[model samples]
Target: MTAKEGVATGSVPSATPTEVADLARVEDRISFLYFERCSVSQADNSITVTDDRGTIRIPAATLSVLLLGPGTKISHKAMVAIGENGSTVVWVGERGVRMYAAGRPLTHSSSLLQRQAALVSNRRSRLAVARAMYQMRFPGEDTGGLTMQQLRGREGARIRNVYRRLSKETGVAWDRRAYDPDAYEDGTEINKALSAAHTCLYGVVHAVIVALGCSPGLGFVHTGHERSFVYDIADLYKAELSIPVAFRTVAEEPVDIGSAVRHAMRNVLYDFSLMDRAVRDIKALLNDDGMADLGGPEENHVGLWDEKVGEVAAGRQYGPDDGE
Candidate 1:
């Protein structure tokens, strides 16, 4: 039977997402998937993608993020199987810009998410997590004496020094780090390199966050944006991985400069084992046992002030009278 037929005919049951269980580590899944001009459907226990070139099979269980780009048609059968495998599917345009939609979490357990929310909600916990993140970036430095403001100042200066040093080393004239996302294609080679590097970092970080069943919105340093936590974590690796790769890309100045920078970023990610590193970093950040109580019923963690924004989402007070 064809893969789609096999899945749809009920000859084989596609496992529910929660039933598959989370992978032991984030790196165990396909970190990123960008599909263009292809039709995706189910085949037996896997997903098959077909384009003008040919057909390829992806083990659905190993998928982390699937970026459905332009000219991509996905069958419901395929979507069902993909969702069951716990893959986050994103619909995007060419060059992977303009994301339209993405999948929800496949997990029933809220332990990791509760820890994230607890850390984000309390001032002390928030600052502690933020410091922990910064400590990861700096490494070996005792930051106990540094206040939040001072830590931010030091981080800014450190990044400036990085830009200046890399500029001097690679002869890439970089005065200030600036990129207008609205006018993305209009930027210079360095700016494009920087943009490319950031997006790549964002993608991988997003995957790790989703894979580990963490809410990308519960950010320590940043807030508001859906992937605020992703941006927060990506900042840890920016100076070490993305910025240098951008500078090196400008130094070489390949014909397809954007492509070259992305290629370089991929090389660095692989060489440094960022997938595994990200998983480890996330585990370390949220491993606090104190957060277990926070994952309980809404009444236990809920308070009178209505401080917990997520409480509304918990369906306790989400009546039809309440504006959604």
Candidate 2:
């Protein structure tokens, strides 16, 4: 996510609605913005966020996700503008501890989602994708021969090493990963930082998954949850992005650890260009056609499926007498 920039103020514009083609590419846009206790409405080509302080306008076209935290309200006109801009809106609890709802996919095409479903549904393809995911984390090493159990073991060891290394470097005490969701205050400072950082990362990953029209429930490594795919993708970056940040935040011993971690995470995401990397990584992971990019096109399409051939034309009546 890019740094939050200053906003201008204006009235909602009365002009031609935004076209998908006019919107910025997903990789080229700002990852997300979090708002709370504010009123969101449309203003000209931007979205106006008004609070007790004042209202400010944010460019809707370049924003990929809008996170509305507790005590926030939005207008229908603002939602329409955001939807037209292909931006995803997510509702979450304070400090982004809980996720309540999410908006529509940014992409008009369902091609990537179809490919993801197909890959996850088949045993062979699902294993291939899972291995690919492992291969991503273990670059310069081949994981083709590793079974699911072996992969899980390897991953566990790898993460433990990460925690130990980061703890040593930051001089923060390291312990086993422990967190009680119902009791946030019960977790250690590092654990709280980890949760806060991971939640922010999950929010971004969830946005990217849906923006590409991919299913959050269809996952190769994770399953049996509404955000299985979100966890799967978020894991890809935790080692580099969140883990170190959490340790560093704990070392600082900030007054509000969660807020500090979130702020740090946003900057880290911008510096890493994580949004662009995520789009590219997801394409290569799911790309089986040996093509350059498998992220799919931005065009909207609807069609009828056929058995013998591929897809058939949509919006036409199929009559036996006419065909005969």
Candidate 3:
């Protein structure tokens, strides 16, 4: 039997929504989800889904994940409803369905604590590297190269500058750093944590772009014809979303690096809820009128937003007024 079929008939008990309101409210939050093995059925004007936890019944909207047996069939009406709702529909084994609410709304507030921690940690690491680089590049100045304390100061300033820019652009004031690393950890340890966190953050960004409908290969900040700009956008969120969580996960779990670490990082891509925020934020940014026109018929039409449209227009091989 297929995995879907095995899940449907498996001895595992289904998971039920703890509260009906929880299910109803879920539509507004996470529009996408992963269900390992589950069953969905329609009865008495209500659709019920059974999983290892329990059974949940409510009005059917759009089901993105649907798994049915080889001979199973689905009605066109169901398919239409699913499509109309912008839900992703997946069919697997017999009598199994996984439904994810499409366009799931996300709030920065919900993840503020974790995001703030990540930002602070990342900023610290970046500043540390920058200070080291600066000292190496310019030795024996009046300052005798920046010390760890000086690095912290520079880190704070740079983070604040970036934070202010992001706030002005996005209208969100992120939390500032609260804890001092000198009181808690050494510089080398902090740097190591930061690197691991950054790698995980990159992974999350890639996942988010894939979830959102942007090709990762097209990029904005990291210039290269072959590079994925969407990946760059995702990278922007690493400091605010993924890094802190990865650090905490690694610190708390303390697992040795191996296949397990790789696997754990993959799971953390979804666990930290970075993908959800990535999709939501990217969609907003992409849909904005100020956003540069990235996808079009031009050969080098990279969608890098510039405040001065005339500058980009001048750089363009073909202007909007130019006739093809």
The lDDT leader among the candidates is: 2
In model 2, the runs with Cα more than 4 Å from the true position are: 1-16, 288-298, 320-324
Question: What TM-score does model 2 achieve against the real structure?
Answer: 0.90
List, residue by residue over 236-281, the lDDT tens digit for candidate 1. Answer: 9999999999899989978876567766877788787787888778
lDDT of 2: 0.83
Question: Which ranking of candidates, highest TM-score first?
Answer: 2, 1, 3
lDDT computed for candidate 1: 0.73
| Tens digit per residue, CA lDDT, model 2, 50-110 | 9999988898888888888889999977887787676788887766677764656666777
Clashing residue pairs in all predictions, respectively, total: 1, 0, 26
Backbone collision tally, model 3: 26
Q: What would the per-residue lDDT of candidate 3 be over residues 8-81, giving only the tens digit for each residue?
A: 13563222211221222212332233233455554332345566789775443323223232343444433433
Note each model's CA RMSD in angstroms: 6.8, 4.8, 17.0
TM-score of each predicted structure versus truth:
0.78, 0.90, 0.31
